[model samples]
Target: MKNVMISLAVMGAFGLSMPAMATGLVAIPAAGFTGTAYTLCNTTGNFGSSTPTQPTTGANNTCATFPANEATSPVSGYTLIASTNRNAVIGGITVGAVSDRVWRNTAQTSCIFGARFTASNIDWDTATTGTQYFEVNDIARGGFGSASVNAGYYIQATNASPVYRIGRTFTSVQHRAYKYDTAANKLLLGTNYLDLPTANSVNTALTGEVTGIGPTVVASTTSATQDAIVNSNWIDFTIDVAYVDDDGGSNIVSAMTYVEAACDSSAVSGWVKTGAIRLRQTGQENTTLQEISIDGYAPPGSTVP
Candidate 1:
């Protein structure tokens, strides 16, 4: 009967562990998670006033986010491309801290600039509402038994819609250097690099800010359990993409966007259950997450300087 996000009081109640530090990394395979995974979200904009792309579940998962004006996005026109054709059976919940890649294309339409972005979800997927809800885990009161697989980081989306708000739960994430798929609409998630972009990681919100002292980690024993933390401070993760223009035409496009979130665990919109002591489905554990990193990007090349 508590907030699904695992309250700080609950953590304090469970903090009576064998040997652990207040701000140290949690052991891996903790919180019902055997490995690590990054949740991804896409938005449209520049650092100043960019907006997250509308989460339209089952509507051909969007890969790009174009800002409103040139001041908002680098894409000439405020156009976000949606690819058709069920290319390689995409869309599903992937688990663990696995290596993933991001690629985008115009789907053979031959657009001016092929652009798109993807990010790691904070706790669950709040892109859809009403039965289509997807979440990592929700802990019950008294540390009964709970199970969760949220990697503690999400590139959340923000808006008035219930879905967007729910998507920004727990921990937030930041991304960089979205690559271009070799195939027209194939959003690749692996190797094959060209020229990468420089990325910097700032703990604007990082995951611990809203969730726990560390990443989202939980362990439930007989009477005590370590789990997600709950705070209400607005969390922010930003990425600034820079493109230098050697051509006199001024084709340089460098901009960034910020994805803000909160440490709320209301469980209202749509929160699923992971691993917890409440359900008697979890056991003692620990997990340490790696820092987020930017993938890679290639700027448009020109002969003129």
Candidate 2:
């Protein structure tokens, strides 16, 4: 199995309008891979934060919107393609939405996954007293061996209530990856982890593990402990899976994951990158992943082109 590494970060001052809505944008990386990749940002936290709110019978709980200009970059031998922007809604209300974008290195990519939400408005601190809180969800390739992965992150606010806060609060960075079996509709291997700030200059890490057979894997991991805030607020994460297929033998696994943190600033955080590489099977050569810098800022203007 071969191990490949990918590093990523977001920079610049992007403009964001108020009114409590969800929006998404896509971007293509410099490198390419064999499988397909999709990025989704949902009102739910599965991708990161909580979920959006929705009415039971029929009300406005969800909505959809579009992003401005899409960007693309080429790295290695792959072409990264991004999307303009998109919106996600729950029930009828618009929790928070995202831009639906994807990157494909080849046509042989197989996987149809994205992100979703449960509710639109809920409180995070108290849920009952504080403000409305939301939940996040993720969708991945259904089958194993030849499946693709898709995930997203988003935020939502309470409509009538004025407790919920919108826009970038504290910078929170997270990442996850999974292997699935499309045939039986099962998840083979997966990981869910989160990194957040603690105290003054410390950061904490939280993680969840998935285990079991085809399509019936069970998740049983504790929440991450509170750590110092390494980088205040904004951060980036990436996951890479590299493997080899024999004529009729077992599938070789080579996985590499990375995390990038930006420096603390009243305006934005500076970029800092870190990564880890490992092989699932033995007899394979070990690989080293490179670190990349990231810049964070707000986008200017209301129209995206």
Candidate 3:
């Protein structure tokens, strides 16, 4: 339940254009970055060229695109690997639409989980409200299957869930690890409750959570709250595979980087549109070019890389 601090570095960028052949959960390297910042992009398509395209500020670049309606497969570029039954009812609440995808660096060293969604209004849970099942959000290893829950580790926020009894508005983000049963097809109780910001940044109370720094940008000190996820917004969280493993979990890192995984935002109920769930390799933990740790586990003096 401690606050993790890391200096904010400029968001890195890539220049490679989307390729037609590159598709699915294939790992591709986002050019090795020299600065402490990790390379990032808003790619919705395939990867091409020797250097992966870097992201720039104010550019809502398109790596993948969907039509006016929900898309089973991306119109162009890579396809989503996860199943369709994404937003299952948890804690007696039904998450409207939670579409997800995964991307990785070719090195398969670092891993990131990103969930995108569109909503006109965002909801928040307060301590006074007791518990509202739909207020929480989640990032899990498997898609919310039709018949059963996926067997793996999942990170769920407390919101107002009785599990942690969290009541704060912004601080409601709980970083607890829960396991699912393959045999039973259900989610087990959570353990290892670590306090985490709803969004990973110097200040979780600002738009910086949604508006990321771009490749050319040198540095950033801006801040914003966990605002609404509208207009196909994407929020990414760095996954510490080793940290989870040390805490009695296994294969989570491998499943995320090499195998299959899914992340979704239940922050908004009755979501208008669902976006791609993506994963990207950030290299191993404690690296000079790693993204900010979502669980506040940044190495001493580590800034966003």
Candidate number with greatest lDDT = 3
Model 1: how far is 193 from its true place, Å? 11
| Ranked by lDDT, top first | 3, 2, 1
lDDT of 1 by residue, 105-185 (tens): 223211121112222222222353322111112111111112221111121233211111111112233111122212221
Each prediction's whole-model lDDT (CA)? 0.20, 0.20, 0.22
Q: Estimate, for each residue in 154-226, the C-alpha lDDT of model 3 and write its tens digit.
A: 2122111001111111121222223222212112212322222222332221122222222222222222232
**TM match of model 3 to true structure:** 0.24
Worst 10 residues of 1 by lDDT: 276-285
> Which of candidates 1 and 2 is the stronger one according to TM-score?
2
Each model's TM-score? 0.19, 0.24, 0.24
The C-alpha stretches of model 1 lying farther than 4 A from their native spots are 6-33, 41-186, 192-240, 243-305
RMSD of each: 23.3, 20.7, 20.8
Error in Å for residue 81 of model 3: 7.8
Deviating ranges (above 4 Å) for candidate 3: 1-32, 40-59, 62-83, 88-96, 100-126, 129-305
